[model samples]
Target: MARVKRMERVVALTKQLVDHPYQLFSFTYFCKKFEVAKSTLSEDVLAVRAGLEAYDLGRVETLAGAAGGVRFIPCHSEKANEEFLTELALQLAEPERILSGGMIYMTDLLFKPQLVMRLGEIIAQRLRHLEPEYIMTVETRGIPLAVFVARAFNIPVVMARRVGQITEGSTVSINYVSGSSKQIQTMALPKRALPSSARVLVIDDFMKAGGTARGMAELAEEVGAKVVGKAFFIATQEPEKKMIDDYTALFVLKDIDTENRKIDISPL
Candidate 1:
């Protein structure tokens, strides 16, 4: 194979690292792939790291040791995060989003691939310090966001179901009240979905009374897993106190005036 140029190597290296964030790649692997000396590859990696940081794309981390390697950690600058959240808040605040029961319609934005991907990056950046081994969420709406966060961390997403599936075999179940409806609900997870003593990050698209988030935490505990962190894309401001005290929410929902068809939401 012909020798690859420095510029070509840097671009290729950036793509691989960015595409597989948090996945470690050994120097030996890259050296063989590029057919270049370790010293040359080091310079190429430096250039790639610099470019990524300059653009606030993410970060490239290098670990030293026989078992250590390089990996990418998805992140964004504070300014960038502020700008994106502000724009998203504006969109979410539109009057048309108000539903009949004072609920704000957000299913569209939650499912948008491009939008949720960025939200995932921001959430992952905030919770990365926890070093969670798995991303957990309840089934349905929150799955996409959780999946994206798992992708950023290069980890698997474990989802709990509203009702236990026969296929899941033995399951752990819990009954919790709905913060909004004040109705009792049941959520369950397969015993095999999460291993005992693993660190878990609970993610959800929306939180009201925090009952669901609290229930997820309980589910994690039932399996002997530790709840390292909890995150929500949007959380309501009322009730002031949430069932779970520790959580990160990108946006706060102030109120919704169904009578006037208005929404009061803003980024935090």
Candidate 2:
């Protein structure tokens, strides 16, 4: 039989486990599929996992012992998060993305499907231990991450829209300043939506002064739903500097200067 190129087969196999990373599978099965030894298969998977980390393309997490086997979870290492966020900073450097105000065209990056998918995975990894029953976000920008987290948990995401959509049922409204600009923004949530007992992870794309987070926290409280924690894709300001605390971010865009075209991206 013609032999399969080791790199080609191993990477292919690694990508297959994206859907169910925590499931158990055997080395002998892989050996038969790849026509390689137990030792060679082990080495090949390790190499591929390492390459994945280098590229910031998720992770190759393994399980061991009597009830254990190998699986690949879509997760971000600290380096991976920083690498992806750096790429995003370059995209944000485009002149067209800059708005009339000082705001960079960050909304585009926040809305991109592929970027959102990865960002969602990074958020999911952070909250996986929390085991949130639902994902929550304030309307507009936060919707993307909330959707992705909802998908990861196979649950529905509830949005606190700034203006109540006619489609939303049984609503309650609250007023607070937006974190980015300190402009007062009113956020609304459907009263009947999230059950009071639900444990929710609040998600969004960015946190500047954290006024939006505060608004969401208030909305969550009004519903009697517990805000177990919060997560954001980027934080323009440090959490310590903000009024709110206990949140995780995949990256922070430390600086952005369009004229000199310099930007800083870091993982947290």
Candidate 3:
């Protein structure tokens, strides 16, 4: 291959790092791919990192030594994160989004690949320090969010199902009260899905009474997985007391006025 120019190399490198976030690539691999010297590749990586930081897109971290390389971490600057969340809150506050049961219809938003990926990036940035081995979530709407977060971390996603499957083989099941309906519900996971003492980051699309998240935490415990953190896309304020104690949420649904069809939401 012909030698790649500095600008072209920088652009290509940025795309490669962003596409494979949190995965390390050796310097030798890049040197060969671009037909450039180690010094030239170093300059190229630095330039890409600088551009990403300036734009608040994310960050590129370099590791030294023979086993070292570059890794991309998906995180925005503090100011950028706040601004983006604020805009998202406004979009979610539209009255049309309010449903009859004090719930905001958000399935459409969660299903959008780009939007969910961005939300996942923000959550991954917040919880990356936990060094979770696996991203876990209950089956359904939260699956997309969890998958994107797993992608951001370069890890795998483990899902707990409401109904047990024969294909999953022997499973561990737990019964918990539904936060909203106050009805008993069972959630299960494959016995071999996670190893003992695996660190888990629990994610969900929404949090109301927190029963669902709490149940997931309990399920993780049964499998000997430590629950490092719990995160939600949106959490409601109606149930001030939640089943789970510690958790983070991107947006707060302050009020859903069914009578007036008005919705109030804010970034946390």
Candidate 4:
């Protein structure tokens, strides 16, 4: 194959594996299909990973244990995060996606663990390089995928709650604007959730106007934790472009016409 053609195949294959994480795809299979030796295939994999990093897509991970394999992690690039987020902004505008309560209906997308996990991989991969001490998210919905990302890097998971409980003990709370309502909402964390100077990566399922994100960031600050980065599965369009300036997203949904049963999703 020509240089350009071979490079394209490398990129395509990387995306395939990323689109399906936890499932192993042996290098041997690609070696045979591409009619290339293991060494050359390895080099191609590196190239693909580098290309992704160059574009803020993610990174490649090669497992070495008995059940080892390659995987793609969609980590945000420092350079292209804004452009990537703009793509997500576009996807949130679809007319059909708005719910009766005005809350975006994303239950279907959030329920798909495979896709969510992969999306988590992208968020995890980007923060992994930053070497954050832990991944943080709000209680309930954000926990599932936040836990996944924490597990991905073998790091601990810290969850903030809408209300404090005796079970969690001593806590800190911060008032942040709710992304959906543009009203202040309280988010709390256990005093021991993290230590001073520890690095934190904030994550959540969806971002409408970034109130929740700002809240979490504020909480991190109160605890003396360093808010290193933030990311989400889907970031909706921001009419005012409120506080979530330094964040990344897997994709954006725009123009959701629920009455039309139409949805549009694309990389951000």
Candidate 5:
């Protein structure tokens, strides 16, 4: 193989750090692989960090000492986050996106890999400082978002099911009131899913009254895990009394005019 140029090496190193979010890499590995001096490698790392920050791509951090190394923390500036959400809200506000029962047709948006990846990055950045041990979400719609966030944190994804499954052994089930319907519902999780006293971050695709989010939190309690934070892709403004009060959301469903087939949404 031909020798790689300095610029090429810097680009390659940046990709590796960005792809392996939150994972540390020692300078020794890069120095040996690129056959460069420690001082040269350090300069390359600084250049990569500067580029990421200037372009609002993310952040690169370094540590010094025996256990110290460099790691990439996924994040975008607050202004950029707001701009992205504003554009997304416009697409979501189309009259055709409205459905009966005050529901917005977001299935197409939710499944888009590009959009989901960005959403995960923003949510991960907001909750990353908490140092959550695992990412949890209810089964089905929220699974994709949870998986993306788990990748960002280099952690595992824990799921809760509305109905218990025979394959999952020794399950713990709990009943919570659905905030919208005011009816009791059951949610279950496997006993071995999480360790005792784990710090969990909960992510959901959408929130109406936050009953499902609350139920997942209760289920986490059953396994002795503490909920560090909760986040949502979208949330409705109706049903004034939400089961869960403290949470973060990307979009707020301000109003839905069923008669006129119109919708209003805003970024938070």
Candidate 6:
């Protein structure tokens, strides 16, 4: 095989690191793959790290010593996060998005792959310090967000079902009151989906009273797992109180005037 040029090696290294966020790769492994000296690979890695830092794309972290390796950590700048959330809040505040019941129609926005991918990155970056072992969410709209966050951490996503499926085998079920409707709702998860003592990060699309988010945390406790953090795409400010207290949300929904066809929302 021909020896790869410095520029070509640096680009390839960047691609590999970005494609597998949070995954550690040893210097020896890359040195062998590119048929280059350890010194050459070190310089290439420095170049990749500098480029990533310059653009605020993410981070390239290197560990030293015998059990050392390099990995990519997905991150977003505060300014970038603020700008994106501001634009998203504006888009969501459009009068046409308001429903008859004072609810904002956001299905279209939640399902967009590109948009949700960015949302996931923002959430993941903020919560990455918690070092959650798995991303947990209920079935449906929250799945995409959970998957993308899990991708950023190189972890698995575990989903609870609204109704237990036979395919899941034996499962644990729990009933909790809806924060908004005040009605009892049941959610279940497979016994084997999560292991004991695992750290869980609960994520969801929206929160009104945080009933669903609370239910997920309770379910995690039932499985002997700890709820390290909770995150949401949007949370309402009306209730003033929620079932869960510690949570991060990208946007706050302050009010929806059905009569006037107006929605009041802002980035948090």
* Cα lDDT, all candidates: 0.91, 0.75, 0.91, 0.74, 0.90, 0.92
| lDDT measured at residue 243 in model 4 versus the true structure, 0 to 100 | 70
lDDT of 3 by residue, 1-268 (tens): 7765788888888889999999999999998888889999999999988998888788899999989999899998878889988988888988888777677888888899998898999899988789988989998999999999999999899999999999999999999999999999999999999888999999999999999999999999998999999999999887899999999999988888888877888999
Tell me which of candidates 2 and 6 scores higher on TM-score: 6
Model 3: how far residue 245 lies from native, Å: 1.1
lDDT tens per residue, model 2, 162-248: 898788776998988776676887889988888997998889877877888889988988888888888887777433588588878
Query: Taking the tens digit of each residue's C-alpha lDDT, what string does model 6 give over 163-230?
Result: 99999899999998988888999999999999999999999999999999999999999999999999
Show how many residue pairs clash in every candidate, following the order shown. 0, 1, 0, 21, 0, 0
Q: How do all models score by TM-score?
A: 0.97, 0.68, 0.95, 0.63, 0.94, 0.97
Model 6 score (lDDT): 0.92
**Candidate 6 Cα deviation (angstroms), residue 90:** 1.1
> What tens-digit string does per-residue lDDT give for candidate 4 at 5-119?
7767777777676665434567887777777888988888888778777766666788776676677655565545556445444545455557775456666656667756655
After superposing candidate 2, which stretches have Cα over 4 Å from the reference? Answer: 1-73, 76-81, 93-96, 179-183, 238-240, 258-261
lDDT digits (tens) for residues 117-210 of candidate 1: 9999888887878999999999889999999999998999999999999998999999999888889999999999999999999999988889
| Pairwise lDDT winner, candidates 3 and 4 | 3
The TM-score between candidate 6 and the true structure equals 0.97
Evaluated at residue 28, the lDDT of candidate 4 is: 84
Local distance difference test, candidate 5: 0.90
Per-residue alpha-carbon lDDT of candidate 5 for residues 158-236, written as tens digits (9 for 90 to 100): 9999999999998999999988788999999999999989999999999999999999999998899999989999988
Q: Residue 23 CA error for candidate 5 (Å)?
A: 1.4
At residue 191, candidate 1 shows an lDDT of: 95
What's model 1's overall lDDT? Answer: 0.91
